[model samples]
Target chain A: MPQTHTFEMGMTCGSCANAARRVLEKMGEGITIDSIDVPTKRIVVTTEKSAEEVKTQLEKTGKAVSGVRITHIESH
Target chain B: LHQGKVSVEGMTCMSCVNHIQDTIGAKEGILNCTVSLQEKTATVIFDGSLWNGESVAEAIDDMGFESKLIS
Candidate 1:
């Protein structure tokens, strides 16, 4: 099964958002970040990693990352 | 010619990009400025004799934009 995680990251501007987006994109295969909303300070990513792992790694960036929610996708 | 790349964080939409670019471009010593939302970066062509990279970054910071020197 695949999953999508939404994270509220600390992105002060577009450059920072771009940096964080790049970091999350490399998480795993078939994983993709849907969008990064700067106004909401959110990084919406859909990945294969466990919800906890995604949150943990996202926090490791050492930024203001929190408010993570995961949605499970059934694999065919 | 001294060029500086100021990587800013938090700009989500074009409005933010416009605000930051407008603010920085208006600063003194900045000869040219290019902003990319995809790259999340602002490249400025300036006269080092007039201003330093720190100053350029500071200008953006003062405008409420999180900025760092990439170059």
Candidate 2:
């Protein structure tokens, strides 16, 4: 089952957001980025990967990650 | 210790610079890291036995930026 993970990131500019997007994109397949809003410092993604795994990857971007929440889930 | 220059792109603010410095500086064998947003480069002093220009550049590239070994 694919889960949507919402992450709190400390991004200061568009480039930071872009970097975050790229980091998540490189985490192999089965991951879709819903949004990476710099102003709100939020990143939303739907992926089959675990939240811990995704968080670990995001941290590699050298950004502070405040938290993660499972926003949505699909039942099928 | 050895010094290497890496050209990094996609950094727009001081936060980016500081993040690069803080992250890489804390890594093992990295003596220091100075990132210049204006110049779009990062100069790293690291243990030559543990790191090289290619590895340092690869580290920056892994951070979601376009990086190349300058020297």
Who wins the DockQ comparison?
A: 2
Query: Could you list the iRMS of every candidate?
Result: 8.6, 1.0
For all candidates, what are the clash counts?
Answer: 10, 0
Candidate 1 stretches greater than 4 Å from native? A1-76
Candidates' C-alpha lDDT = 0.72, 0.91
Per-residue lDDT of model 2, residues B1-71, tens digit only: 89999999999889888888998899999999999998999999999999999999999988988899999
In order, what DockQ does each candidate have? 0.09, 0.79
Instruction: Give lDDT for model 2.
Output: 0.91
Tens digit of lDDT per residue, candidate 1, span A1-76? 5678888876666765665655565464666778988799988777667767766655544456688787676676
Q: In TM-score terms, which candidate is top?
A: 2
- Candidate 1, residue A62: the lDDT equals 44
